[model samples]
Target: MSSAFEVRGGNRLKGEIIPQGAKNEALQIISAVMLTSEKVTIHNIPDIVDVNLLIELLGDAGVKVNRISRDKCEFQADDIDLAYLQGADFKKKSGRLRGSVMIAGPLLARFGKALIPKPGGDKIGRRRLDTHIIGFEKLGARFNYESDDNYFRLEAPGGLKGTYMLLDEPSVTGTANIVMAAVLAQGTTTIYNAACEPYLQQLCKMLNSMGARISGVGSNLLTIEGVTSLGGCQHTMLPDMIEIGSFIGLAAMTQSELTIKNAGVESLGIIPEKFRSLGIQLEIKGNDIYIPSQETYEIQTFLDGSILTIADHPWPGFTPDLLSIVLVVATQAKGSVMIHQKMFESRLFFVDKLIDMGAQIVLCDPHRAVVIGLGRQHPLRGITMSSPDIRAGVSLLIAALSAEGKSTIQNIDQIDRGYQYIDERLRNLGADIKRV
Candidate 1:
């Protein structure tokens, strides 16, 4: 059943909140469990819809899943039903999860064959699988797409042979997928222009612990020395940096004082600085981030006095995932700023909903939007809106919380896909929101 969030706006939420495990990291790490027959223990798994759905799919693949706790689990893929990969149920489930594609690399590497349905998630833009497919082909895997059921089949008849390849783009999932495949391939593999996000780094570290020989973890150029087999290992996920960034935006938007606990501050490269550039005052104490209630915040301009522009880049840069939060937070700041969403063309489309709520945002194009801050002088008035994607859903939720009147947000399932018990968490923080 579809649900909506009924938010009574203008509530200054206060209290501390801890972010869930990194969703992106959880997806990759959980999928890596398929690489070994031994038991792999994972900690800090997010109890979100998408992650849970992936776990369910894994269970259906004949993996032994022990639910150790809400945030932890153990997986043993010793008896995987390889035939299940081509079943109708697998197609239906995996097709709905974009992260399901990552499982192919592990399955192919371990079992010499894999099949994945056309994966789906947020309809942000054209998230191509070419990087993954091409990388696998370079590793000596034969690829075939069956249009009848929309499944991509990969087979390594003679097992995978490692080779050097440069990625066209530093796709996070693509890099992780290729790395997982190359880790068990025969001989050496060198990947240039690989994604070096903290989550990817975590995956590499975990794979190494499992006996996979991989080096150059935190750098774009990765060298993998293939090992005959991998063993079981325990890995813990970092706090979701995107969620941490969202909390900073939320505190600034509602003029609320919030402390985000166990934020994994060290791994959050450039996220804090990006939020700070928006003039949101935040203090890092130990591992927690303290954001004080602010009457108003201003946007920082460039050194040349030009209008500030916030754009997304690969790791070590502002993440594209949080650009929606940044755009929504910029709506009520004390200055004008340009939000350049270079990665996904449709990401900036959610600004129209904010504009309807009285935020002065100019939709320049599909990729860029100019936000003129209301400065809290003219507070936004609430209205009914629908969530288009996960990040945009949370962005709208933040805008609705800061608006003047009651706001109704439909399609809340999108929000639930990424956030773990978000409504309950916000309620604990004094937000006047409820599910309907």
Candidate 2:
């Protein structure tokens, strides 16, 4: 059986907490290591289950992996065997996480062919692979999806030649994959409507350090002049912004004066501002976020004095990944807010669990939830619940920390995939939480 968290609520947590390395960036950067055979040294990597699984998958493909430290590692892809990639065992390993789909770009760029099984991850909504597959096809690669076995095959026998293409949406992983592939193509490639998240910028900068000619570092339009090969380079990942956001919400809901150190405030786009809209007071002391304890916070209204709605969009907008935490935070605020999860259809369904914990939440639809804050007037009663996904699992954990009694949360494997030693970290903050 999977481990669960037994949380004793109503604890006032204090002290500083450090956010881990970005899980999303680690996946993309580690896959890019296969683009070169040189020793690629990476620092500040999150020691999370997902990242470890990706590393094991790379090892299965015959890449030389060395764990230099807990937060540091090196990769050498000199002996990458194509036969291992085509085997059933490799497919099973790749299917364990969604990041496996990213291997297709580097594999195809270097070997002219790639194969992948159906990617597995949180079933929040219809996350279509069309963006990735179609983008690869637009760049002169032939892609075939074997529906019988749910596998994908991509090939470019004549070698990829860079071309200009416009993406339907700014998909983060899609842009990373295409950019990685285009860097090794024969000619220049211009990608419009590309994702420009800080993680992508970091990836592009790291690629440039590896001798890949990529321009437009922080914009929707990217230009890449194909290079012959990529050399190894050193990379340091930014702190996980989602984890920082979670910590901020945790401090607010539990009414604790907590500080998040080295939060990479510059890279956190619109996240601090989004939480501030919920009337959560924040002090930015250099790179640290200090949330002071408060009895209650009032949700802000629109300039027209209407109810404020929080929704997700592309980068520079509030991320859909944090909407569940935002919903839980609203439960204790002084007013109401409508959380519209525009990207994922099933994410808001987790609100039913919150409602059972004494939160006044209305599940308007699978995509929307209206939360009316109880203003700390009535404390939430702890209850046993099962975590559905990563973000929702953490949100429910936060709720349990501020509830009236002890609560049990199951399916903690979902939580471990993204967070590194979360229970231990919370314990250091004076929270009575344990992994059972």
> Alpha-carbon error at 383 in model 1, in Å?
0.5
Model 1: worst 10 consecutive residues (lDDT sum): 111-120
TM-scores, each model vs. reference: 0.99, 0.99
Q: Model 1 over residues 1-436: C-alpha lDDT tens digits?
A: 7999999989899999999999999999999999999999999999999899999999999999999998999999999998888788888889999989999999989989988777699989888999999999999999999998888989999999999999999999999999999999999999999999999999999999999999999999999999999999999999999899999999999999999999999999999998899999999999999999999999999999999999999988889999999989998898999999999988888888998999999899899999999888898889999999999999999999999999999999999999999999999999999999
As for candidate 2, its clashing pairs are: none
252-334, model 2: which lDDT tens digit per residue?
Answer: 99999999999999999999999999999999999999999987899999999999899998887788889999999999999
Against the reference, the lDDT scores of all candidates come to 0.94, 0.92
Instruction: Flag regions of model 1 displaced more than 4 Å.
Output: none
